[model samples]
Target: MIIAIDGPSGAGKSTISKMLADSLSMHCLDTGAMYRAVAYLRLHGDIPEHDEKSLVQLVRKTELNFHHTTSGTQIFWDGIDVTVELRAPIISQEASRISAWSAIRKVLVELQRKICGSGDFVVEGRDIGSVVFPHTAYKFYLDANVQIRASRRQQQLKEQGIIKDVKTIVAEIKKRDFHDSTRKDSPLTKAAGAILIDSTSLTKAEVVQKMIIEIEKIKEKLGKKGKTN
Candidate 1:
Protein backbone atom coordinates (compact mmCIF):
# COMPACT_ATOMS: atom_id res chain seq x y z
CA MET A 1 0.00 0.00 0.00
CA ILE A 2 1.21 3.46 -0.86
CA ILE A 3 -0.20 6.66 0.62
CA ALA A 4 0.84 9.91 -1.06
CA ILE A 5 0.73 13.16 0.86
CA ASP A 6 1.37 16.35 -1.10
CA GLY A 7 1.65 19.80 0.40
CA PRO A 8 3.46 23.10 0.48
CA SER A 9 6.16 23.87 3.02
CA GLY A 10 5.18 24.18 6.69
CA ALA A 11 1.80 22.51 6.17
CA GLY A 12 2.95 19.71 8.51
CA LYS A 13 3.02 17.03 5.86
CA SER A 14 6.29 15.56 7.18
CA THR A 15 5.15 15.29 10.79
CA ILE A 16 1.65 14.12 9.90
CA SER A 17 2.93 11.61 7.39
CA LYS A 18 5.35 10.16 9.96
CA MET A 19 2.52 9.73 12.44
CA LEU A 20 0.26 8.19 9.83
CA ALA A 21 2.95 5.73 8.82
CA ASP A 22 3.52 4.76 12.45
CA SER A 23 -0.18 4.25 12.94
CA LEU A 24 -0.27 1.89 9.97
CA SER A 25 3.17 0.30 10.45
CA MET A 26 4.40 1.50 7.10
CA HIS A 27 7.64 3.23 6.12
CA CYS A 28 7.56 6.94 5.40
CA LEU A 29 9.71 8.63 2.76
CA ASP A 30 10.32 12.35 2.55
CA THR A 31 11.05 13.12 -1.11
CA GLY A 32 11.99 16.70 -0.37
CA ALA A 33 14.96 15.57 1.65
CA MET A 34 16.20 13.63 -1.33
CA TYR A 35 16.30 16.79 -3.36
CA ARG A 36 17.77 18.65 -0.42
CA ALA A 37 20.53 16.07 -0.33
CA VAL A 38 21.25 16.81 -3.94
CA ALA A 39 21.48 20.48 -3.12
CA TYR A 40 23.70 19.64 -0.20
CA LEU A 41 26.06 17.70 -2.41
CA ARG A 42 26.35 20.44 -4.98
CA LEU A 43 26.90 23.12 -2.37
CA HIS A 44 29.53 21.14 -0.46
CA GLY A 45 31.25 19.90 -3.59
CA ASP A 46 31.46 23.34 -5.20
CA ILE A 47 29.35 22.26 -8.16
CA PRO A 48 27.68 25.20 -9.82
CA GLU A 49 23.88 25.23 -9.74
CA HIS A 50 23.52 26.38 -13.35
CA ASP A 51 25.84 23.61 -14.44
CA GLU A 52 23.05 21.19 -15.26
CA LYS A 53 25.24 18.48 -16.71
CA SER A 54 27.41 18.39 -13.62
CA LEU A 55 24.38 18.38 -11.36
CA VAL A 56 22.75 15.44 -13.14
CA GLN A 57 25.99 13.52 -13.21
CA LEU A 58 26.50 14.19 -9.53
CA VAL A 59 23.07 12.82 -8.65
CA ARG A 60 23.42 9.77 -10.84
CA LYS A 61 26.78 8.78 -9.44
CA THR A 62 26.14 9.54 -5.79
CA GLU A 63 24.19 7.06 -3.68
CA LEU A 64 21.29 8.36 -1.59
CA ASN A 65 19.90 6.16 1.14
CA PHE A 66 17.28 6.57 3.86
CA HIS A 67 17.40 4.79 7.21
CA HIS A 68 14.35 5.26 9.41
CA THR A 69 15.11 4.68 13.05
CA THR A 70 13.03 4.90 16.23
CA SER A 71 13.90 8.56 16.57
CA GLY A 72 13.62 9.75 12.92
CA THR A 73 14.75 9.17 9.37
CA GLN A 74 18.47 9.46 8.69
CA ILE A 75 19.52 10.47 5.19
CA PHE A 76 22.83 9.17 3.90
CA TRP A 77 24.44 10.86 0.95
CA ASP A 78 27.11 8.77 -0.69
CA GLY A 79 27.48 6.67 2.48
CA ILE A 80 27.85 9.73 4.70
CA ASP A 81 25.08 10.73 7.07
CA VAL A 82 24.11 14.27 6.07
CA THR A 83 20.63 14.35 7.51
CA VAL A 84 21.19 17.27 9.84
CA GLU A 85 22.92 19.41 7.24
CA LEU A 86 20.17 18.98 4.69
CA ARG A 87 17.74 20.96 6.82
CA ALA A 88 19.69 24.20 6.69
CA PRO A 89 17.74 27.19 5.35
CA ILE A 90 20.14 27.81 2.49
CA ILE A 91 19.83 24.25 1.27
CA SER A 92 16.06 24.55 1.29
CA GLN A 93 16.23 27.48 -1.15
CA GLU A 94 18.80 25.75 -3.30
CA ALA A 95 16.79 22.55 -3.35
CA SER A 96 13.77 24.49 -4.50
CA ARG A 97 15.74 26.15 -7.27
CA ILE A 98 17.50 23.03 -8.53
CA SER A 99 14.29 21.02 -8.34
CA ALA A 100 12.98 23.13 -11.24
CA TRP A 101 15.43 21.52 -13.62
CA SER A 102 13.87 18.72 -15.66
CA ALA A 103 16.91 16.45 -15.58
CA ILE A 104 17.21 16.74 -11.83
CA ARG A 105 13.57 15.88 -11.23
CA LYS A 106 13.74 12.92 -13.57
CA VAL A 107 16.63 11.38 -11.65
CA LEU A 108 15.15 12.03 -8.19
CA VAL A 109 11.59 11.07 -9.19
CA GLU A 110 12.81 7.75 -10.49
CA LEU A 111 14.72 7.20 -7.28
CA GLN A 112 11.68 8.10 -5.18
CA ARG A 113 9.46 5.66 -7.06
CA LYS A 114 12.02 2.88 -6.71
CA ILE A 115 12.38 3.47 -2.95
CA CYS A 116 8.63 3.49 -2.28
CA GLY A 117 8.09 0.51 -4.56
CA SER A 118 10.13 -1.61 -2.16
CA GLY A 119 7.68 -1.34 0.77
CA ASP A 120 4.39 0.02 2.04
CA PHE A 121 5.27 3.68 2.36
CA VAL A 122 3.63 6.90 3.40
CA VAL A 123 5.30 9.24 0.94
CA GLU A 124 5.29 13.01 1.46
CA GLY A 125 6.51 15.70 -0.88
CA ARG A 126 5.53 18.46 -3.28
CA ASP A 127 4.62 16.09 -6.10
CA ILE A 128 4.17 12.67 -4.56
CA GLY A 129 0.41 12.54 -5.11
CA SER A 130 0.41 14.49 -8.37
CA VAL A 131 3.35 12.75 -10.05
CA VAL A 132 5.15 10.12 -7.99
CA PHE A 133 2.18 7.92 -7.12
CA PRO A 134 -0.60 9.17 -9.33
CA HIS A 135 -2.41 5.84 -9.44
CA THR A 136 -2.35 5.18 -5.70
CA ALA A 137 -5.73 4.58 -4.06
CA TYR A 138 -4.94 6.90 -1.15
CA LYS A 139 -3.81 10.46 -1.74
CA PHE A 140 -4.02 13.65 0.26
CA TYR A 141 -3.17 17.30 -0.30
CA LEU A 142 -2.39 19.10 2.97
CA ASP A 143 -2.46 22.87 3.04
CA ALA A 144 -2.70 25.81 5.39
CA ASN A 145 -2.85 29.58 5.16
CA VAL A 146 0.50 31.18 4.33
CA GLN A 147 0.73 33.04 7.62
CA ILE A 148 -0.05 29.96 9.59
CA ARG A 149 2.39 27.95 7.58
CA ALA A 150 5.07 30.54 8.21
CA SER A 151 4.39 30.47 11.92
CA ARG A 152 4.74 26.71 11.94
CA ARG A 153 7.97 26.88 9.99
CA GLN A 154 9.31 29.43 12.42
CA GLN A 155 8.64 27.15 15.33
CA GLN A 156 10.33 24.24 13.58
CA LEU A 157 13.42 26.27 12.81
CA LYS A 158 13.49 27.46 16.41
CA GLU A 159 13.52 23.84 17.53
CA GLN A 160 16.55 23.37 15.30
CA GLY A 161 18.16 26.36 16.99
CA ILE A 162 17.88 28.39 13.82
CA ILE A 163 16.03 31.64 14.37
CA LYS A 164 14.56 33.79 11.66
CA ASP A 165 12.09 36.65 11.58
CA VAL A 166 8.49 35.50 11.08
CA LYS A 167 8.02 38.04 8.30
CA THR A 168 11.10 36.72 6.53
CA ILE A 169 9.87 33.19 6.80
CA VAL A 170 6.48 34.23 5.43
CA ALA A 171 8.05 35.81 2.38
CA GLU A 172 10.28 32.80 1.82
CA ILE A 173 7.32 30.43 1.95
CA LYS A 174 5.35 32.54 -0.54
CA LYS A 175 8.30 32.48 -2.89
CA ARG A 176 8.70 28.75 -2.41
CA ASP A 177 5.01 28.17 -3.08
CA PHE A 178 5.29 30.03 -6.35
CA HIS A 179 8.41 28.10 -7.38
CA ASP A 180 6.95 24.73 -6.46
CA SER A 181 3.59 25.35 -8.12
CA THR A 182 5.03 26.89 -11.24
CA ARG A 183 7.88 24.47 -11.88
CA LYS A 184 7.82 22.99 -15.37
CA ASP A 185 8.77 19.33 -14.91
CA SER A 186 6.30 18.16 -12.26
CA PRO A 187 4.66 21.07 -10.54
CA LEU A 188 3.18 20.66 -7.08
CA THR A 189 -0.55 20.02 -7.34
CA LYS A 190 -3.30 18.08 -5.70
CA ALA A 191 -3.87 14.80 -7.46
CA ALA A 192 -7.26 13.68 -8.70
CA GLY A 193 -9.25 11.78 -6.00
CA ALA A 194 -6.95 13.15 -3.32
CA ILE A 195 -8.69 14.37 -0.18
CA LEU A 196 -8.06 18.03 0.58
CA ILE A 197 -6.94 18.68 4.15
CA ASP A 198 -6.85 22.18 5.57
CA SER A 199 -4.63 22.21 8.63
CA THR A 200 -4.51 25.91 9.35
CA SER A 201 -6.18 25.52 12.73
CA LEU A 202 -5.75 21.80 13.21
CA THR A 203 -3.08 20.09 15.30
CA LYS A 204 -0.72 17.46 13.91
CA ALA A 205 -2.45 14.65 15.82
CA GLU A 206 -5.82 15.81 14.55
CA VAL A 207 -4.61 15.77 10.96
CA VAL A 208 -3.08 12.32 11.29
CA GLN A 209 -6.21 10.88 12.94
CA LYS A 210 -8.41 12.26 10.19
CA MET A 211 -6.12 10.77 7.55
CA ILE A 212 -6.03 7.40 9.33
CA ILE A 213 -9.83 7.25 9.37
CA GLU A 214 -10.00 8.00 5.66
CA ILE A 215 -7.32 5.42 4.88
CA GLU A 216 -9.15 2.77 6.86
CA LYS A 217 -12.33 3.53 4.97
CA ILE A 218 -10.54 3.11 1.69
CA LYS A 219 -8.93 -0.11 2.84
CA GLU A 220 -12.27 -1.53 3.89
CA LYS A 221 -13.84 -0.64 0.54
CA LEU A 222 -10.93 -2.29 -1.30
CA GLY A 223 -11.23 -5.42 0.80
CA LYS A 224 -14.94 -5.69 0.02
CA LYS A 225 -14.28 -5.37 -3.72
CA GLY A 226 -11.53 -8.00 -3.59
CA LYS A 227 -13.82 -10.44 -1.79
CA THR A 228 -16.59 -9.81 -4.28
CA ASN A 229 -14.29 -10.45 -7.18
Candidate 2:
Protein backbone atom coordinates (compact mmCIF):
# COMPACT_ATOMS: atom_id res chain seq x y z
CA MET A 1 0.00 0.00 0.00
CA ILE A 2 1.15 3.53 -0.79
CA ILE A 3 -0.25 6.26 1.45
CA ALA A 4 -0.06 9.86 0.29
CA ILE A 5 -0.21 12.58 2.90
CA ASP A 6 -0.32 16.19 1.74
CA GLY A 7 -0.39 19.36 3.78
CA PRO A 8 1.26 22.69 4.46
CA SER A 9 4.30 23.00 6.65
CA GLY A 10 3.96 22.46 10.42
CA ALA A 11 0.69 20.64 9.93
CA GLY A 12 1.90 17.37 11.52
CA LYS A 13 2.34 15.58 8.20
CA SER A 14 5.83 14.46 9.11
CA THR A 15 4.99 13.29 12.59
CA ILE A 16 1.83 11.50 11.59
CA SER A 17 3.38 10.03 8.47
CA LYS A 18 6.28 8.61 10.47
CA MET A 19 4.11 7.10 13.16
CA LEU A 20 1.66 5.72 10.65
CA ALA A 21 4.45 4.23 8.59
CA ASP A 22 6.05 2.67 11.63
CA SER A 23 2.77 1.20 12.72
CA LEU A 24 2.04 -0.21 9.28
CA SER A 25 5.57 -1.55 8.86
CA MET A 26 6.05 0.56 5.78
CA HIS A 27 8.77 2.90 4.63
CA CYS A 28 8.32 6.63 5.22
CA LEU A 29 9.27 8.98 2.42
CA ASP A 30 9.56 12.65 3.25
CA THR A 31 9.29 14.25 -0.17
CA GLY A 32 9.57 17.75 1.23
CA ALA A 33 13.06 16.98 2.42
CA MET A 34 14.05 16.14 -1.12
CA TYR A 35 13.09 19.66 -2.17
CA ARG A 36 14.87 21.07 0.85
CA ALA A 37 18.03 19.26 -0.20
CA VAL A 38 17.85 20.99 -3.56
CA ALA A 39 17.43 24.33 -1.82
CA TYR A 40 20.27 23.60 0.54
CA LEU A 41 22.54 22.88 -2.39
CA ARG A 42 21.48 26.09 -4.11
CA LEU A 43 22.01 28.13 -0.97
CA HIS A 44 25.41 26.54 -0.61
CA GLY A 45 26.34 27.38 -4.20
CA ASP A 46 24.92 30.89 -3.98
CA ILE A 47 22.64 30.04 -6.85
CA PRO A 48 19.64 32.32 -7.14
CA GLU A 49 16.26 30.66 -6.75
CA HIS A 50 15.05 32.14 -10.04
CA ASP A 51 17.93 30.67 -12.01
CA GLU A 52 15.95 27.90 -13.58
CA LYS A 53 18.77 26.76 -15.81
CA SER A 54 21.22 26.46 -12.96
CA LEU A 55 18.58 24.96 -10.72
CA VAL A 56 17.76 22.36 -13.31
CA GLN A 57 21.39 21.49 -13.71
CA LEU A 58 21.90 21.24 -9.95
CA VAL A 59 18.90 18.98 -9.40
CA ARG A 60 19.81 16.76 -12.32
CA LYS A 61 23.04 15.85 -10.57
CA THR A 62 21.51 15.54 -7.11
CA GLU A 63 21.04 12.19 -5.41
CA LEU A 64 18.85 11.71 -2.33
CA ASN A 65 18.89 8.62 -0.13
CA PHE A 66 16.77 7.73 2.88
CA HIS A 67 18.15 5.48 5.59
CA HIS A 68 16.03 3.87 8.30
CA THR A 69 17.86 3.94 11.58
CA THR A 70 17.33 3.49 15.27
CA SER A 71 16.94 7.23 15.61
CA GLY A 72 14.62 7.44 12.59
CA THR A 73 15.00 8.17 8.89
CA GLN A 74 18.16 10.04 7.93
CA ILE A 75 18.31 11.80 4.58
CA PHE A 76 21.49 11.96 2.56
CA TRP A 77 22.06 14.51 -0.20
CA ASP A 78 24.75 13.48 -2.65
CA GLY A 79 26.38 11.29 -0.01
CA ILE A 80 26.28 14.01 2.66
CA ASP A 81 24.13 13.66 5.75
CA VAL A 82 22.05 16.82 5.59
CA THR A 83 19.10 15.81 7.74
CA VAL A 84 20.15 18.38 10.31
CA GLU A 85 20.33 21.29 7.87
CA LEU A 86 16.99 20.75 6.17
CA ARG A 87 14.82 22.49 8.76
CA ALA A 88 16.52 25.89 8.70
CA PRO A 89 14.12 28.72 7.98
CA ILE A 90 16.17 29.82 5.00
CA ILE A 91 16.04 26.37 3.47
CA SER A 92 12.32 26.13 4.15
CA GLN A 93 11.76 29.45 2.35
CA GLU A 94 14.04 28.46 -0.47
CA ALA A 95 12.42 25.04 -0.78
CA SER A 96 9.05 26.69 -1.16
CA ARG A 97 10.39 28.88 -3.98
CA ILE A 98 12.49 26.45 -6.01
CA SER A 99 9.84 23.79 -5.65
CA ALA A 100 7.70 25.98 -7.87
CA TRP A 101 10.00 25.40 -10.80
CA SER A 102 8.40 22.96 -13.18
CA ALA A 103 11.66 21.35 -14.17
CA ILE A 104 12.76 21.01 -10.57
CA ARG A 105 9.49 19.42 -9.51
CA LYS A 106 9.70 17.00 -12.41
CA VAL A 107 13.17 15.92 -11.44
CA LEU A 108 12.21 15.41 -7.80
CA VAL A 109 8.96 13.64 -8.58
CA GLU A 110 10.76 11.14 -10.75
CA LEU A 111 13.19 10.52 -7.95
CA GLN A 112 10.32 10.17 -5.50
CA ARG A 113 8.66 7.49 -7.59
CA LYS A 114 11.95 5.69 -7.98
CA ILE A 115 12.38 5.72 -4.23
CA CYS A 116 9.00 4.07 -3.72
CA GLY A 117 9.50 1.33 -6.27
CA SER A 118 7.52 -1.83 -5.39
CA GLY A 119 7.50 -0.90 -1.71
CA ASP A 120 4.84 0.03 0.80
CA PHE A 121 5.58 3.68 1.40
CA VAL A 122 3.93 6.40 3.42
CA VAL A 123 4.82 9.39 1.28
CA GLU A 124 4.11 12.92 2.50
CA GLY A 125 4.46 16.15 0.54
CA ARG A 126 2.51 19.00 -0.97
CA ASP A 127 1.72 17.12 -4.17
CA ILE A 128 2.34 13.46 -3.50
CA GLY A 129 -1.20 12.20 -3.87
CA SER A 130 -2.19 14.49 -6.72
CA VAL A 131 1.00 14.42 -8.74
CA VAL A 132 3.32 11.74 -7.48
CA PHE A 133 0.90 8.90 -7.04
CA PRO A 134 -2.58 9.83 -8.18
CA HIS A 135 -3.65 6.19 -8.45
CA THR A 136 -2.98 5.43 -4.80
CA ALA A 137 -6.31 4.55 -3.19
CA TYR A 138 -5.40 5.88 0.23
CA LYS A 139 -4.75 9.62 0.18
CA PHE A 140 -5.13 12.19 2.94
CA TYR A 141 -4.89 15.96 3.13
CA LEU A 142 -3.96 17.24 6.57
CA ASP A 143 -4.50 20.82 7.62
CA ALA A 144 -4.87 23.17 10.58
CA ASN A 145 -5.51 26.84 11.14
CA VAL A 146 -2.57 29.01 10.15
CA GLN A 147 -2.08 30.27 13.69
CA ILE A 148 -2.06 26.77 15.12
CA ARG A 149 0.38 25.63 12.48
CA ALA A 150 2.66 28.53 13.23
CA SER A 151 2.61 27.74 16.92
CA ARG A 152 3.49 24.13 16.23
CA ARG A 153 6.29 25.24 13.95
CA GLN A 154 7.59 27.55 16.65
CA GLN A 155 7.53 24.76 19.20
CA GLN A 156 9.35 22.43 16.81
CA LEU A 157 12.08 25.01 16.37
CA LYS A 158 12.31 25.62 20.08
CA GLU A 159 12.76 21.91 20.66
CA GLN A 160 15.73 22.06 18.32
CA GLY A 161 17.12 25.11 20.21
CA ILE A 162 16.31 27.51 17.40
CA ILE A 163 13.88 29.96 18.88
CA LYS A 164 12.03 32.54 16.80
CA ASP A 165 9.18 34.84 17.70
CA VAL A 166 5.73 33.35 17.16
CA LYS A 167 4.63 36.37 15.12
CA THR A 168 7.63 36.11 12.84
CA ILE A 169 7.05 32.41 12.34
CA VAL A 170 3.36 33.02 11.70
CA ALA A 171 4.08 35.56 8.96
CA GLU A 172 6.54 33.24 7.29
CA ILE A 173 4.08 30.36 7.44
CA LYS A 174 1.41 32.47 5.75
CA LYS A 175 3.82 33.57 3.06
CA ARG A 176 4.90 30.00 2.38
CA ASP A 177 1.28 28.85 2.33
CA PHE A 178 0.50 31.39 -0.34
CA HIS A 179 3.47 30.37 -2.41
CA ASP A 180 2.80 26.65 -2.10
CA SER A 181 -0.89 26.95 -2.95
CA THR A 182 -0.57 29.47 -5.78
CA ARG A 183 2.45 28.10 -7.56
CA LYS A 184 1.97 27.39 -11.25
CA ASP A 185 3.84 24.11 -11.03
CA SER A 186 1.96 21.43 -9.12
CA PRO A 187 0.32 23.83 -6.68
CA LEU A 188 -0.72 22.44 -3.30
CA THR A 189 -4.38 21.44 -3.11
CA LYS A 190 -6.46 18.59 -1.81
CA ALA A 191 -6.04 15.61 -4.04
CA ALA A 192 -9.07 14.02 -5.64
CA GLY A 193 -10.58 11.26 -3.45
CA ALA A 194 -8.50 12.36 -0.49
CA ILE A 195 -9.97 12.50 3.00
CA LEU A 196 -9.41 15.87 4.63
CA ILE A 197 -8.38 15.88 8.28
CA ASP A 198 -8.62 19.09 10.26
CA SER A 199 -5.81 18.67 12.75
CA THR A 200 -6.06 21.88 14.71
CA SER A 201 -7.32 20.30 17.93
CA LEU A 202 -5.89 16.84 17.46
CA THR A 203 -2.79 15.63 19.18
CA LYS A 204 -0.20 13.83 17.11
CA ALA A 205 -1.22 10.49 18.55
CA GLU A 206 -4.87 11.23 18.00
CA VAL A 207 -4.22 12.21 14.38
CA VAL A 208 -2.30 9.02 13.78
CA GLN A 209 -5.07 6.95 15.29
CA LYS A 210 -7.62 8.60 13.08
CA MET A 211 -5.55 7.83 10.01
CA ILE A 212 -5.16 4.22 11.09
CA ILE A 213 -8.89 3.85 11.54
CA GLU A 214 -9.48 5.18 8.05
CA ILE A 215 -6.91 2.79 6.63
CA GLU A 216 -8.48 -0.14 8.39
CA LYS A 217 -11.83 0.69 6.89
CA ILE A 218 -10.31 0.96 3.43
CA LYS A 219 -8.57 -2.36 3.77
CA GLU A 220 -11.74 -4.08 4.86
CA LYS A 221 -13.63 -2.61 1.94
CA LEU A 222 -10.95 -3.74 -0.47
CA GLY A 223 -10.99 -7.21 1.02
CA LYS A 224 -14.69 -7.50 0.41
CA LYS A 225 -14.35 -6.23 -3.16
CA GLY A 226 -11.64 -8.78 -3.84
CA LYS A 227 -13.74 -11.63 -2.47
CA THR A 228 -16.67 -10.64 -4.70
CA ASN A 229 -14.46 -10.36 -7.74
User: Which number leads on lDDT?
Assistant: 1
Pairs of residues at least 3 apart in sequence or in different chains that clash in candidate 2:
none
Residues 1-229 of candidate 1 have per-residue lDDT tens digits of 8899999999988888888888888898888888888899889877975998898897788777888653457899878899988889899989999999898888888888887778788889988878888888898999999999999899989999988999999999999999899988889898898999999989888999999888878879888542110
- lDDT of candidate 2 over 104-147, digit per residue (tens): 88888888888788577889999988999998879999999988
Scored against the true structure, residue 51 in model 1 reaches a CA lDDT of: 95
Q: How close is candidate 2 to the true structure, as a TM-score?
A: 0.92
Model 1's TM-score against the true structure: 0.94
Task: Report backbone clashes per prediction.
Answer: 0, 0
lDDT for each of the candidates? 0.86, 0.85
After TM-score superposition, what is the CA distance of residue 29 in candidate 2 from its true location, in Å?
0.4
Clashing pairs in 1: none
The true-versus-predicted C-alpha distance at residue 140 of model 1, in Å, is 0.2
lDDT of 1: 0.86
